[model samples]
Target chain A: MAIVVVNVMPKPEILDPQGKAVTNAGKRLGHEGFSVRQGKRFEIEVGEVTPTVLEEVRHFAETLLANTVIESFEVCS
Target chain B: MRVGVVTFPGSLDDADARRAISLTGGEPVELWHASDDLRGVDAVILPGGFSYGDYLRCGAIARFAPVMDQIITRANQGLPVLGICNGFQILCEARLLPGALIRNQVQTFTALDQPLRVESTRTAWTSAYWEGQTITIVLKNGEGNYQADPDTIAQLEDEGRVVFRYLGNPNGSLNDIAGITNQRGNVVGLMPHPEHNVDPTITANLDGRPLFTSLADYLLGATC
Candidate 1:
């Protein structure tokens, strides 16, 4: 079995409160001068990995897994 | 007039929306999100709630529901539709409305009586109110920040399609926009629970009654 992973993150111009909160938490934990942005990861298991399958997963990531309005997504096999 | 209120799996305010419609003397039709039929209602209302558990994102999964397919088709044909709170998120996801609603800047769920200025009284939903009228209604949501690209914001402003503006900017929405209408003025999306303020017995504020009355008047072909 092969798995395809998709990573989705908020667009740069959009505000990500969850990411800001995580950065602040990291600061409280003594990690300074670091910024973090939260995002989502989805793994799709398939019988076999192929170009066609990767394209299909990319389509799903664009249309459903991530909202293009406030998000950007990347697909990897 | 018949106004259909859609009820998705996690829709919490469908009953309140239906009640508001009934109180306004319109027949309330219950529409199921899993079904594609709208029951031939004169108008449709997508009420507030965390539909489909708000997975992936708020209203992301719910946007693909069978009912939304019909709504998208009918709305394009000039059918009147109103989306409230989570429904607003769904509308943006479905591309019926411009922009997106993101997590609140404070990263917290907020609930309060919010004051809004009516920016436009020309849509099917706001005809009963005078332009610039201020009304207070319930505002409750965790992800209610509205964002759009600069060009779209400029166009909405130039065209006067912004239907409502927040008086105090509760959720960090762009330009303090609380609600907006489509170019055709048949569809509206807002991140406030107007239905919650319609019943006087439940809440002393009846500011939301005008929204239902506006639709009723519009359906009756009355010039408000």
Candidate 2:
């Protein structure tokens, strides 16, 4: 199965260095209404993928991969 | 003793960490982030920098580097491991230690010589220091604030797990915590850069030398 770990961070309440840089470059490229929030995306190939396994992995990401203080994550197929 | 300095992509202080370990009379071995073997080093130092480009948050992507597999194993076996700044974030990311480093209170990269109070000398890295002794070390990072659930913080405090506290609130960390040691004292993570202050010319007062010296004194029987 294709297991993906998408690291999520808050969308800019305003002032995201990575996002701002992207937006500026996008505007220069003539792509208006472009916005982004910096985040991490990891693709892991595991032995098997199951609901229990997904929950376990989600918990792992919650405690390790993503900071809950200002960040959250989701597991998708 | 031989110490291993693991270099993940974007890691900036690998050389400085090597130099500090060498000055302490311990041989420094270069370990790669994608390798699972430690090459028989006595201890490991995860130097500061934007590992994995600080993607998915600082130290997050690099937490799963192949080297971390062995680091987890060795650290679990009581091998000494010290994580600095970005390295500190990785330790938390890898669950080798506890707590997470959040953004600075002011949300800007703060770089300066910060004074920190040594909270405990029980760890291999801090044994050279006296409890409550304050020393100045350099701090540089955008995401260095430390945050933990209240229960976790209380547990750490009640168990004397906190190892250092910043005299100046450079990052707005909870309890001004600058460093913490695991229950075994074998794994430690701190926000400041002790490796950067190893040289007298760099620190001007040689304040950060004791951390390396103390570790060498314990694991290698050699100290400057």
Q: Which candidate should be chosen as best, given TM-score against the real structure?
A: 1
For model 1 the TM-score comes to: 0.98
User: lDDT tens digits, residues B20-89, model 2?
Assistant: 9887778899999988989988889999999878766788888888889889988998899999999899
Give per-residue CA lDDT, model 1, range B1-224, as digits (tens): 98999999999999999999999889999999999989988899999999999888999998999999999999999889999999999999999999999989878899999999999999999999999999998999999999999999999999999999999887788999999999999999999888998887898999999999999878777333
Instruction: Please state the Cα-based DockQ of model 2 relative to the true two-chain complex.
Output: 0.15
Supply DockQ values for each candidate: 0.90, 0.15
For residue B10, what is the lDDT in candidate 1?
94
The sequence of per-residue lDDT tens digits that candidate 1 reaches over residues A1-77 is 99899999999988889999999999999999989999999999988899999889988998999998889999988
Task: List, in the given order, the native-contact fraction of each candidate.
Answer: 0.91, 0.09
RMSD of 1: 1.4
The DockQ assigned to candidate 1 is 0.90
